[model samples]
Target: MGPLIWIIDEEWLDYEDEIRVLEQAFPSCAIKKSGYDYRGDLDKFGYLADAIISQIYVKLDAGAISKLEKCKVISVYGGGYDRVDVLSANKRGIAIAFVPGYCTDDIADYVMSCILRANKPIDSYGSALNDRIWGLPAAGKLRHRIQGSRLFIIGLGRIGRTAAAKAKALKMEVSAYDPYVNEEAMDSMGVRKYDSLEEGLGEADYVSVHARLTSETEGMIGIEQLSRMKPDALLINTARGKIVREKDLVEAVTNHIISGAIVDVVAVEPPSFDEPIFHCPGIAVTPHVSYLSVESFKELKTRTAENVVKVLRGEELKDIASV
Candidate 1:
């Protein structure tokens, strides 16, 4: 009998192959898979798990953490661990690990795709053609082009820096607002630094948000920030959802406060289909898949398993977020 490991899963079909990988990686440990509904439901497993691994949609709140009395580590298979209560887990002396820098390229690529999509008339042309409209004039017209467009990045972190490089490659003027980042670093990447977020919002034709979700950043882009944006600008958020208020965003897009928005996340994952933002023509929402790619997905799974193994062996764990 080896250490007990429990994998909180979404569905058997989804984790079929991933579970096999974990089994092969930790043949010395007994792994269990179960679904959790309520806060303390995971306590019914009857064994103190040595470690717990989960993907998105699994909320490891303080109550749930209390039930995992023997849990030594919590491994999250994603770039961000906002879904998990790291502070609470740390109080229990349980280390939390997340796969960072694994999805930087994927997220940056997705942001660029959204930026280009917002600037082009692809949707308008497709809709017009479906209606039997002919000719360029009837098809669609777009005044904003990708090249020479002003791009303002909200955070100059890994993803933000990658986005800046891509935007510059397209001949777009790139600027960023991150007081924590050094001005010399921004200049090296050909990005202008803005001391104030409001100034950047007022000047940008497109804004991409990559800031982490923390006490100071939650609801950072509320009504006042949105109001400062150009009426014809486009806003992109590939970072956390709560960083920008979803209700305010829906209102902004519906009222054309900004031309439109491309959001990969929202306040709630798998929001109701009847959500107002989904009904709006100007707002496009992806199901939090901006960090997805065949390569990144495989890496995330492998790294998560490795991290757990390291914890079991009492080795130094990589990407420790609980610190």
Candidate 2:
């Protein structure tokens, strides 16, 4: 029998197209589709499939892992694998594969837009048209501008570093905090390295969060960190949603502590209409579209299918996250 690649989520136009390409490349591979999330229904594929193509950001509960019998591989659709329990998959002898660098360029572009919104005086734009003012807040308050601002990035990974480069090109002073990165790397990026979050936030006119979301990072940005930012500072997060405590940001922005904030990932997707963070006047919200672009999506799908085919053919997988 040919190997069946089970798609756990509905067809992503990019991913399905890649599956077709993989079938041609391998010829022994057949595709299987799951109508809804297979979170609690892994057993459904027990008799028909051998692997899974999982959604990038969705989480797969432990119950789902307990049911799979024939599944020997997992192909993640995007940069993140927070959805799949890597430990469980490893112990079960499944090869979990994904594509990472694919999203760096597109995500960096999105972060730049988020930072631009965070630092620019958006309200002033409207007032300039009606009240005959210009980009600067000529009378009522001090103005905000991106060119001379100080930007502190939380993580120095690909996306974070890319953002730092853009920030530098804007003539902003860029610094980064990532314990894993050593002095030489920091020097090469022409960014100062900080050993602690407080040290990083203390000197910034802006903060860009690009860290991964782990137990240690959940609620990482809260009241204390917000308090350290300058009154005109901007906080931007295009990374994980849970890394910032939603309530803390609500209180900070509501109290006018920082200048403004922007978030692409939310603690919950499609946050409730009443999500206080949504109504926070100075915040810009994006629906986790940071890694979205037709070109990037195509790369993601092609890489995911290629990874799956490699495992089936006993070749090395492209970008498999470690357990």
Candidate 3:
């Protein structure tokens, strides 16, 4: 019998066109599917899987990892794999793969869109016009011009570097804080490097986060960090939600500690009905989809299946998770 590959999660199933590609690529293998209802109980179906493709929401915790007796590869459907228990997967000699560079342009464009909104009266003015309010009273507030404004980015990974380049094109002064990235690299990109995050936030008219979610970064931007940002600074986070504590963010925006936030993620996905940030006036929240574009979507799906085939055939895989 051929290898059994389980493409778990209904989310991936929705991409019917993409699955057809996977079917063709693994013609000899039995490809199966499951609904969102199969989460936590992954072990029951996982034991027989030679390899598995998972959705971003599916948490392959340590217990779940222990049950994958025959699984050789785990292909995450997106850029971030924080939900996957990498340590356990590594201990068991399982290869975890992720599609990373595919989302660089998409995420950078999303962050740039938020930056443009920060300096424009587009939303407020359009809403007033829609309500038939004649006189442009909403235009009274002085908007920050994109040119000559300071933009600070936390974490200079692919997304961060891309955002910095875009900001520079708009004639904005760009600076960044990333311990992992060297000052020479930042200098070459024309981005000023800040020794500390506080120093970076203090001088910014806008701040964006692109850090990975790890022990060092979870709740990285709490009250003390938020307090350091300029009162009118606009904050953008397309990165992980846990990087910023939700309650602290609510308090900051509620009391106007920071002017507003453009958040594409939250501590929880589809946050509880009572998620206070939704009620906060100056915040814009998007369902964690910043890393999406038609092109990137196709790349992510194709690479996921390709990685599994490579592992099954004993070939070196691309973008092996830093687990």
Candidate 4:
């Protein structure tokens, strides 16, 4: 039989608890780790049997997949396995397991916070005091009483639903756009439903994106669609970057096409100032940590380890979406 596993992911550096859990569970099994230089150790220890587990969002390419001749499974640490070419894995009979709830609440909270910040008066809300301009922007204040305003959600999955619920709690009228959603089911959540993107933009005071990154979703929000939004509307993206074109966002924000904006991710991570996004004012940029929180990170680590062990043992897995 192949060795027990190969772990390839950023989570390896971040989740010691998860590493410990896997170590304890697979004490006698042979495992190779991406960050651990297990390949060099293989020269001394000899190649053991091979199995592989990966944190979600790891590099997924033909070259990477070609190296996994002995891999039988891939356990993604967090949700959104777009980083993995699912069709390729499926064709190779390599089943992939994912942890879905890792960042559920964290992302929901972050999305709501961004929306609130955008709507809140700049002078009073306190985040505009970045000291960049020595607080000149602080002189220009934002105004809001969000209680009666409308919030439109682009996706209606778990995180999307959570955001909608939070918006409702904040007394904001919630509308969602997802043709795939069950009408009766969505209605029970007190969220209004819009079948098209244009409808959502036309009626919303704030728009929060929670969609997945798929072929159908790439660059779904760009100049053409952004033009449909209310002149003073807020656009917030906690979802994957490709959903919105990075260039279009910069142009929109730079030109003040939208009232204000917040993005937890960009189509390109750490986008350059020359790319135009970095030069825009009234836009908040956060390094892809909307899904990160101490509480959620703990849960993510535990779930990741559990999934790894399950895959190694050929056990049934959870959250195996579309594969």
Candidate 5:
């Protein structure tokens, strides 16, 4: 019998790209597709599967991992794999692979867009014009200049570094706070490294978050951190949702603890209609689409399948999880 590959998410519009890649690399492999709310027998599915492709919403916890009999790897569709239990996968000798750098440029561009939107007040002007009101709105008169403004980045990973470069191109003074990244590295990029988060928050005209979601980062930004930022400072988060406490962010923006916030993610995906964050006009929330672009979407799918092939063929995997 051919190897079985299970794709455990109905999120994709179609799986032609993944199917084509797998067929080219492993002709005889069988593939299965399931919805996000898969209620089928996981035990049978896991036992028969040679490889699995999963999205962020599917949780492959320890109990789930124990059901795998022949699974070689779990290929995550995106950069984040927090939903998968890495320790359990490691214990069972199953590799975890994710597609990284597929959306670096896309995410960096989105961050720049948010930063510009916050500082320019162009949208406010357009809204007033749409309302048939001639001349600038009161908000438009308070537009802040982007050039020479201070930008503080929470984490200096791939997306973070790219954002720093783009911000510098706009002549914004960029600084970053990442304990793992050395000052020499930031110095090379002409970005000042901050020893403490509070110090950066207090001085920044804008703060952008690009930190990976980990135990150390969950709920890292709270009221205390928000209060530290300048009253007019803007915060941008295209990273994980839980990294910033949603309740605290709503409070901060509602109370004008900071001028505003631009978030592509929140503590929950598809939050309730009455979610407090939605009620606050100062906070702009996107549907967690910072990593999406026509190019990045195709790359994410193709590379995700390629990672599975690499594992099944005993080849070294790219972007392997560091569990």
Candidate 6:
């Protein structure tokens, strides 16, 4: 019998890309698209499958990993594999793979968009005009030019570096706070490095977050950090939501601790209607889609399927999860 491959999520509208790649490599292999409902028995489903493809929605905890008697790999469809329990998978000799660098440009573009919108406020002016309030909206407001503005980045990873480059092109002075990255590296990119987060927050006109969500990073930005930022500064988060405390953010914006915030992610995705972040006038929220683009979407699907094929063929995995 040929190998069995199970796609466990219903995220995509169609499985054409995954199927094309998997079947082209293993013509006789059985490919099952189970979506979120995998019948009633997970153990039986796990026992029959040789490989699995999943998204962030499904939780593959220790108990679930124990059921994958025949599974060789779990290929995650995006950059994050936090949904899968890495320790459990490793103990079972199961490899976890994810796609990275697929959306670096897309995220950088989105961050730049937020920064531009904060400075321009063109949408607000249009809304005011519709209400018969004429004249310039910035008449009494403090507005700074994009050029010569200070931008502080929380993490200097792939997406962070990309955003720094774009900001530099616009003549914005860029600085970053990342212990993992060396001072020489920042200097090479024409960026200043901050040894402490508070120093950067206090000096920046715009603070963009690109840090990963981990035990060390969760709730990293809260009341204290927000308090350090200038009253007219803006906060931008395109990374994981938990990194920034939603309640504290609401408090800061409401109390005028900082000017406002623009976020592509929230602590809880698809948050309830009463999510205070959504109701606050000082905050603008997007549905966590900073990594989406036509090109990036196709690259994500292709690389995800390739990871599963590599594991099944005994080839070294690409973008193997470290934790």
Clashing pairs in 3: none
Error of 4 at 239 (Å): 0.6
Model 1 residue 165 lDDT score? 93
The true-versus-predicted C-alpha distance at residue 201 of model 5, in Å, is 0.5
lDDT of 6: 0.89
Per-residue CA lDDT of model 2 for 1-323, tens digit only, reads: 58888776654643566767677776777776664555444565544457778776556656676577777788888777887888887887887787878889888888777667554545546656777765445445655677877889998999989988988899988899998999799989989999989888989987888898887888889999889888777788888888888888888888888877888888886467678877888887877778878898778788887887788778877588775
Summarize candidate 1's per-residue lDDT along 1-323 as a digit string, tens digits. 67787777563246544556656766677777776453344757723888888766688887788777788888887777877888899998888988888888899999899887776646657666778888766745456778999999998999999999988999999999998998998999999999999999999999999998888999999878999999989899998888998889988888889888998888777567677767788888898889889888778877877778788778997689853
lDDT of 4 by residue, 1-323 (tens): 23456666543455577667777886765555664233443333323325456655455655455555656666676787877777777776667678886788789999888777666544453444555554556656545678999999999999999888888899999999998897898899998888889878988888999888888889999998888888888899988888988778778877778876888877764446365555678677787789887788888778767776776677888667564
lDDT of 5 by residue, 245-269 (tens): 9999989988989989999988876
Give me the overall lDDT of model 3: 0.85
Error of 3 at 154 (Å): 0.3
In terms of lDDT, the poorest run of 10 residues in model 5 is 135-144
RMSD of each: 2.1, 2.6, 2.0, 4.0, 1.6, 1.7
TM-scores of the models, in the given order?
A: 0.93, 0.90, 0.94, 0.86, 0.95, 0.95
Q: lDDT of model 6 at residue 30?
A: 90
lDDT of each: 0.83, 0.78, 0.85, 0.74, 0.89, 0.89
Model 4 residue 76 lDDT?
A: 73
Candidate 3 per-residue C-alpha lDDT over 68-182 given as tens digits, one digit per residue, 9 for 90 to 100: 8888999988888888898899999888988888889899999889988777757667777777777646575686788999999999999899999998999999999999889
Model 4: clashing residue pairs? 2-49, 2-50, 3-49, 3-50, 5-51, 56-77, 121-142, 122-142
Ranking of predictions according to TM-score: 5, 6, 3, 1, 2, 4
Arranged by lDDT with the best first, the candidates are 5, 6, 3, 1, 2, 4
- Each model's number of backbone clashes? 0, 0, 0, 8, 0, 0
Q: Locate the minimum summed-lDDT window of 10 residues in model 2.
A: 39-48
